[model samples]
Target chain A: MSELAMHEIDRLKENLAERAAAEGLIDVSYRLVDSPVGQLMLAATGRGIVRVAFAAEDFDAVLDSLAEKVGVRVLHRAAPLDAAAMQLDEYFAHARTGFELNLDHRLSSGYRLEVQLALPRIEYGHTASYKAMAAVTGRPAAVRAVGTACATNPLPILVPCHRVLRSDGSLGGYLGGLDAKRALLSLEQDPFGN
Target chain B: MRLHGVKMKTNPPFELVVREHGPAVLRMCTALLRPGPDAQDAWSETFLAALRAYPGLEPGANVQAWLITIARRKAIDSLRARHPVPVDSLPEQAAPIDGFGPDGLFENAGLWDALGTLTELQRKVIGYHYLLGFPYAEIPGFLGGSAASLRRAAADGIKSLRKLLDVSEES
Candidate 1:
């Protein structure tokens, strides 16, 4: 497309996004935010932030999942995600230790929700074992389930799933992959359960 | 690794759908109506409507055709809203075509006027067949005309458009 055509179409899309959002036509709004780990695709519902996806997860696939799992009225507007994006930027800069944003946990439920909800209490610069997390959730025998919760955490950083580790203190699996897990843990200056 | 090679029937993200088809839909809207607020509204309405109904659409469906169908409907609705009385055809206008207005959208005012001079059916045929390149056979299903008749309409529309554009250029 020519520059003039591109400008006109962008104006049209911006107008559409605003009007659709005001009229209650937007079901999911999303924007991409940069982080120490990589570019993150943040998507939210009317309730709160829903999914924060890594670039490696394939943004197109992530959006498809959002459309299928949430609502199909997905748009690329940054208004709803501005607070979350700003906070994330602050966190990456080591200026913020915790999130003050509303989160939508519709993507997880039951034991997963229980496990994820307990993660924030782990504190910055501290790691918790899956076995310990299971015990904290009152399911000491479901250490594997705790691992599953961390592995499939719909909201990764904000929920702090990277804090969960193996009983031996080895890095466990993470939804954003183990490398991202290491990057986030080091960024927090993880003292390894100290 | 075993499952990586398997073919999945995943629906494309709606974002991709909009990115790929948005420009064409906007162009179609402007051609169907004049490029301005009304045309922009029709483009937005078409996408919103498409997004609402997109999940139910078949995976093998022709996306462009589906979008153009929606665009046409939204454009007609816009026309209806602007004119209270049923506008079967546009009345002949004797006013000289204006040059570009303050709004950037009016840059193509002459072309828009030339398009406006074509009859509704002729305009539809020319826009769909020549501008957007919808095949004659495919157009009948949406526009409700025989392929033979549509071909004739397009020919006549093209002739009139050429004459109008030539006159505008000379003056």
Candidate 2:
């Protein structure tokens, strides 16, 4: 074959590879949610919610993290999160109060799990101090530790760490940011208020 | 404030739209700006802006194009803020090519180095069209120019790069 023909063949192969890779990426299910804090992109495996990211966060990181955790290459598609996105839209619209979807909690580890386990118990329109959360976890003096746990909570709003507050009736630090914390608190008080 | 009333109307099923477009937008940003911390920051900001404006997107529109445009604007703003001097200002080092096959087509590190020498706009056009396989029509919308202008920009950029790389290959 002539060099030009060889080049043409090479180009065709490259195009085929690129198409296959793109098709693979498009196979993953995806959705967006109007969370109290901001718009969120959610990705899921066949198991459960694999990744969630704020619009501002590097979404590639979320996908990469999911790929690492699931031990499979995550294809980017919007089908999986369709139900979750609807539920989230309802939650934001004040038509719903809680998310009832199955979650893949494999990413939560150690102290983060302890904090997350304490989150759902934090009733809507209410708050819990870090000390209170620590006390509930049978580590009464580990308020700082509980705060660290909250900071590391991978699922954020889903885990309800925003309900964990400072001991002094002030808002504590949130992994998603203070504005998110405030929005969640405000939404709980009056889901339609924000 | 009633200014909140002006918030864009968000369509239902928000996560799906974001997931589909997120990687493309990230790729665009990475192509436009230097990879690393700054690009990461810009990526996040772009998504935040998208989230805030999600409610306003019309149903069944091209969400990928919309997100890419937002990312492109955010990247430009970041470049302005950081005032990344010039591509030539940095040392002329080549990025190691990964995931290439045995064909040796990508082994030409000098070609990539020459590509790096182009202006930020030129580099972005090349990356999006040649590397990422985005359609030529989409280039104008992302770069905020006419389709003809984008085509010319891409052609000129490629011509300049071939010359630069050819010289380097001879050396």
Candidate 3:
């Protein structure tokens, strides 16, 4: 603990802090998509998509939460999301229909999983009633349970929970709002028609 | 969001936790591995693994230390896979991260260099206590060492780092 030694530790701390900040910035980047709902920001690590936020969501809070959960400092930039955003853009444009990126599905499980798992089967230009999904999940009588699952789905669009409808063929519920679901269903009917 | 074993917090969203602490875990990976592209790979793998195992993370837990533990194991495995030597016989020099200045003493480089020379136990101790900003009390649970042992290890590691850097500067 000599003066020089202390100074060195101080220097190391400062250097470490600076490097951490720089690295965090370099590691995190976001892509914005003009979805039918609103602007969607996809935050990605070098490996894959880490977060997706709606336009009304608080960006800083979202970034902070992602960093804390993933145990990495989140750098806010417009770079890493280029690939994911592009894919989403294609999706929104109806040019591309599905995501090929690695997704961090840690935020979802249980009923959410059951619902998400059923989404792909809903097919393009097709929809299933909530009761139908419950039946598919072997909960043939748990139609209300299926509705809850759709409401809790973490990967909304990618999982295509919008395809779940009310037993009467009405749109049941969607995290992105019913209007967004309606728009998505419309787009699926006519990729270029939207 | 709502991880399986974790409780919902009215205080903050979980994504913020990932953003703030992710770099510390990455830094620990770089420190454990030799600097270079492989370190980056290890870091990526660590996060991917973390994402897969995220549901098990308990709320009010020390996420930074938890992540460091996982990353350390992954780094060791990555090192073992790339090298044919027995785990104990694996040379520190085998996975040298390219372009890293000696001991990471250079300001232009990342902190990984300085961390490379320490024993694995020391690295984890210091990583948990200092870089990731964990309290001394939490070190015992995260590292499975006694509180006193953890403190001593961190102190000794800091001393060792200073000495290592000193030697590097002189050379």
Candidate 4:
């Protein structure tokens, strides 16, 4: 193997990685980010951020889920996630109130979809009871269903599902785990048991 | 590892294919085409095409040989494009491929120079068998030569390259 051949191959890899998305080879692009909560996995489709998984959730398992649900054209590309990472950095630092990134919520659907869609309406730095979220989703009697939705929220913090709490304002179960839920609520200035 | 109702058989991912055989394809491309931008273009095009065609590629196929064959065709296309039949006046001196580019990719300039003089078939035969370490028997499927003939041609190519390069180094 000549040094020239090695150089050529490296250049080809760089070229491919740089241009794969534009070339339409990469369908789902993702990246790993560090946050106060933990390492977060950010994956995006052509439309927007599709999945945001917490560290407690194995990143590989999350990726495999994305592969199974989405297409297998997945790649660890950082270009699409660059703007999202900066926004999330501001978010974890408590400097940014809400994410401005477009999101694709195809990871969940039906009643769960309605609950997830209603979560962001809780507003940054605000907490909502499961009953309140259920009412907002036009399913006032589905408070328990709302809890299940918040519990199973695939996008978690990015979708702001962590803002859901009990009617008494007690910290509720979070899909990312209790500690992560508390950490996110704390990051948003939600005092415990308020 | 699957979704409900729709059963998809996952082929080995293309990334593995690239990591495994990319160097050989690049080297083979450089051997057949001129060792510069043209060869580099050929290499890129080969993989880009392979990536497009990968999903339908038959199961348990020889991936390396498949990639090499694609690179071979790409290199030939690039060579023809670069050496378009002389329109009015024949250009003086063949294309300059004696050394590495702005970056020092070639450790040996004499060998690079020697490679440029070999016929395209000789170059492919030698690149697949000698440079890539593919068995002679495996190469015959991608290339037209029998194992024995490819062995002979590769031997002759190496001998000529050694003689040409050794003489040039002394001068």
Candidate 5:
């Protein structure tokens, strides 16, 4: 039904995306990236990466929350997420250990955000107890709160929330399910073997 | 990274809507406003408006029809915003776009020129019905006329195009 050349449509979409960003009509840009874990939906604002969702998480529900919590101008454009996508690809390929990507922390706040921000310091291939996370956040008495923080982490793999374990060194709850948590930990422990 | 199977959602990302209907909307705008900043503005405005209101759209709403309605309104708004210089009194029109050559809508310059010769109603009728595949019965609501008159306009528009492009005698 389209008499316009395919390239013309593509060009128009590109132009619209650029114009939308220029006009601030685009607050959140997102796209799906496939990783070893599963299909990941990555979303970002002009500020930084805002939300990351595993396939197990209902993408529609995630999008609705982003619209409600962030802004209604979320688009499925990939430009803003290009860096995150590349880094994620490298991560899945075992070529990267730390994420140097810019993160927009607006989706989180208070103790939850504090716990999530401290997750990267746990070091790659190393696991930490929720008690340790609470201690790191200077809330040594809030071990349960630390667990809640890791459980509700908005950034997921990017924030390394899977690094947090129970005090007895047991695999704790993961938003992406236990298997995904195990897989990520194993990937970090022995990148080439798994 | 491995391409893991995606869990399907009944509600697709908004980009799919843009990709699906963008070209047709652009073509409609070109036919309605011709190739220029005006057409581009109408196109951009339509999609921006659509994107803002998308989350609240009814689950099974007719997406293309809804977009067409918005595009038509945006085109009308653009037309109204233009300075009312008489078509005959205006200076010779400059080239509409710089790089919209082989990659854009007016690659068939002759066809675009032919389309320009038709009356506004003829152009809209031809664009909505023939180019964008809008039902004949539905053309009236967007462009305003009975279906019967729109069908006549479509026929007359094509006749004019055939004559202007000099394909009638060959056939």
Candidate 6:
């Protein structure tokens, strides 16, 4: 009934993936990340983590957007994202307080990109007002711009954009919706916030 | 951003497609290419190539046929690069995969060695019929014969194989 042993063929596919990575044929590799917030689509270019998408963002649309913005060559190979996935799990477990991986903000631009760049500096378990975030981006008058920046933050949790709030100390708009905002903010305050 | 009504057709999840059809493609390659290492290389390249372009495949397309088409092309590539086909020897099968059936078509154990006695066309016809189960109606486009002739070709090929294999054992 069979002329081929599938296990050997599966081993060949693994070798093919590693060889593809080694040959630099991969433009962007991605994997779905499970977190306290929700399912996230994490994509990375050779540079770094390029995009982190909320489940509501529609994984297929996010991937298509990525294929358009990044190179068309993309695949689901979890190997490259293992370290980042581990850090995310630890962050959710309150065992970690910082993301040490490099980032690629190719999907963001102008004031938004500037805001995204400044987000990681907000510190863990702390909140910064929109005015404060705008100030950090050197556009103190761009408070609304700061809110837009947070709303459009591509790499949300990893970039610490959740730490930005309203000028009145209220949780502001989050790309992943308000409940996810609360979960993340509360998760940060836990002593497990290692 | 939400993309509810995008009108373009894209491939289904590429990983799912790969897992679902990989073994079938591998069997096709093994049946066509005969030699083990060559078959493995062809199988690897086939999926690697598929992964490269899978995102562009149409949603309603026949996935099995598409994969089989690619597998066949890779097998042909291996076939062409293979300098001289194995006219003798085991061609690396060594033992039949999953062992010979109870029907004694493979009782003597050197199936691949017997396969080496077959002509390339005979082997291809026999494999497409018996190993992969592609209907004879669809094979003439690739193998160049009517469905009846293709079936006869397969039958004749297997008859030649039994004679070749049985004589070897008696000797």
Best by lDDT: 1
Per-prediction TM-score, please? 0.73, 0.48, 0.46, 0.64, 0.64, 0.66
**Tens-digit lDDT track of model 4 for A1-194:** 56866776777776875667668876678889998888889999898999888888887677657766776556667889999999988877667888888988888889999889878888888888999888888989999999889887877777888888899988878767788888887878842224
Worst 10 residues of 6 chain B by lDDT: B89-98
Which RMSD does model 1 reach against the true structure?
9.8
Give the range of the ten consecutive residues with the poorest summed lDDT in model 3 chain A. Answer: A8-17
For model 2, residues A1-194, the per-residue Cα lDDT tens digits are 35753454344333322343444422235556666678887876556775566765656556545544553333334556777788777766777777787777777777767778778898767888898888898889888888888887766666678888888989978756788778777888996654
Docking class of 1: acceptable
lDDT of 1 by residue, B62-122 (tens): 6666776677667656755764543334222112222311121123446556777888888
Among all windows of 10 consecutive residues in model 5 chain B, the one with the lowest summed lDDT is B89-98
Tens-digit per-residue lDDT, B76-157, candidate 2: 5675475533332221122212221111213344554566677777887766555434456655645667767877887788
Which docking category, incorrect, acceptable, medium or high, applies to candidate 3?
incorrect
State the DockQ of every prediction: 0.33, 0.02, 0.05, 0.18, 0.17, 0.16
What would the per-residue lDDT of candidate 5 be over residues A27-81, giving only the tens digit for each residue?
6898899888889999998889999999899887787678667765667788889
Kindly list the per-residue Cα lDDT of model 3 for residues B66-151, writing each as its tens digit.
Answer: 66556656766665566443323212222112232322322222345566677877877665444434456655654576889888
List the candidate 6 regions with Cα displacement exceeding 4 Å: A1-13, B1-40, B50-70, B80-123, B126-151, B155-171
Candidate 1 vs candidate 4, TM-score winner:
1
User: Residue A79 deviation, candidate 2, in Å?
Assistant: 1.3
Which prediction has more favorable DockQ, 1 or 4?
1
For the second chain, the TM-scores of the candidates in order are: 0.52, 0.48, 0.48, 0.49, 0.51, 0.49
- Over the stretch A1-194, how does candidate 3's per-residue lDDT look in tens digits? 24753453344333333344454433445546777778776776655676677655566666556655554334344555667777777877788877787776665677767666777887777888887888888888887778877786655677778888887888776766778888888888897753
RMSD of model 2 against the true structure: 18.6
Residue A183's lDDT within candidate 1 is 89
Please identify model 1 stretches exceeding 4 Å from their true place.
Answer: A190-194, B1-13, B36-38, B52-62, B79-125, B128-171
Please tell me which predicted candidate would have the highest TM-score against the true structure: 1
Writing each residue's lDDT as its tens digit, candidate 6 over B1-171 gives 223344444544554555666665665576577657877888888888877766567655666656755765666556546544322321221122222231232223366557657888788876655544455665575666698988887777777876775544233
The prediction achieving the highest DockQ against the true structure is 1
Which TM-score value belongs to model 6? 0.66
TM-score of 4: 0.64
Scored by Cα lDDT, where does model 4 land? 0.71
Per-residue lDDT tens digits for candidate 6, residues A1-194, read: 24346667567766876777887767778889788888988888898999888998888778767766675566677888888999999888888899889888889999899888888888898989999887877888999988888898889899888898887878878888889999999988875554
Give the C-alpha miss distance for residue A142 in model 1, angstroms: 1.7
